[model samples]
Target chain A: SQELEQSPQSLIVQEGKNLTINCTSSKTLYGLYWYKQKYGEGLIFLMMLQKGGEEKSHEKITAKLDEKKQQSSLHITASQPSHAGIYLCGADRSASKIIFGSGTRLSIRP
Target chain B: GAGVSQSPSNKVTEKGKDVELRCDPISGHTALYWYRQRLGQGLEFLIYFQGNSAPDKSGLPSDRFSAERTGESVSTLTIQRTQQEDSAVYLCASSPVGTDTQYFGPGTRLTVL
Candidate 1:
């Protein structure tokens, strides 16, 4: 089984709408990270949540990690066309490399 | 001087051939990693090199995939007897010691026919 799983493989929302993407892990997450990738390009680090119950925000994008450290969510408020990209969540365990989810492709239509 | 860089931005090879992809990490970075992303699939960890030693090769899918780094500068991933399944975008990333953020390269898109 995949160590990390993402919900709603693809999503389309009109501009100015709010959306949320979920990430779940089969095991406890020691460190969770969010990255955004445009088509045909490399990934751009968004934020890192290492502690449980931690929350961080960048512009209109907000990320929250649950207290259990088993799940994390990325929320975008008033989505913009620039927000259209593949959202990937990854988790790193003790002394283990990062494992990424299949990714959620989001499209914000103007 | 800027960020990670990879060479031969794209490659097209036939079956049963050999291919080498290169990666140049940021200056002074000590950790380098290689990953592969197939179409519609998530990134798959292949290998990691910290300084002159690689503590983990567990992610390598097979013996056909091997990577080596000199000091902490440039690294190369070589795949032999390439199969169609090997086609994907290979990405390289580097990070400062103990830092969780990884800076990525443009990636080399490999297409096997």
Candidate 2:
């Protein structure tokens, strides 16, 4: 079985501070995806990284997959209250099947 | 619809009763998936349908849990003789053909008493 472990289960940071969340996989990752979700809502897609050293950025949020394909990270720059949510990392477990990580709860203290 | 949608946003049923949850995928999407998220837990894959391919039931927890998707459109998840431990938020998602980036629905919260 594949396990994608996420670090810092919960975080609280000042409004202007920057933060990073990490997701480590037990095996090689073919595809890594980042998603954000507010409580009681559907997940919002952030970015998808498929190759080693691949990095994608949207707005102030950026995601990168390590060259070893064993880990991925999501970095939020100059966070604000609007960035508060649960950040989840997903990976392809098999053909047509994607599994999610435990998720990281982020709170931007204003 | 513009995005994935699920019916019966909330359901409360007896332990021995059966229940069905529905999911409507986005238009033109050929991949649909079902997942379960228990309280304070991550999403767990349940099943998946890709176009006309054989549906993947590898993630289903038990025999009592079954799901069916009509073509590439809507899907229904049925649970028979539900148990108290069956309570959770069932999520549905859909993606474009040949893509793994899925758009999820709001999910159906099921409660067994």
Chain B TM-score for all candidates, comma-separated? 0.96, 0.97
TM-score, predicted candidate 1 vs. hidden true structure? 0.55
Top candidate on lDDT is 2
The TM-scores, chain A only, for the candidates as listed are 0.96, 0.96
lDDT of model number 2: 0.84
lDDT of 2 by residue, B31-110 (tens): 88888866544567788788898987888899999999889888999999999989988889887875455677778889
TM-score of chain A, model 1?
0.96
Can you give the lDDT of residue A109 in candidate 1?
Answer: 88
Residue pairs clashing in model 1 are none
Clashing pairs in 2: none
Taking the candidates in order, what DockQ does each have? 0.05, 0.05
Query: Please, what are the lDDT tens digits per residue for candidate 1 over residues A39-77?
Result: 433466788888899999999999999999999999999
Candidate 2 docking DockQ: 0.05
> Where in model 2 is the C-alpha error above 4 Å?
A1-110
Please report how far candidate 1 places residue B107 from its true position, in Å.
Answer: 0.4
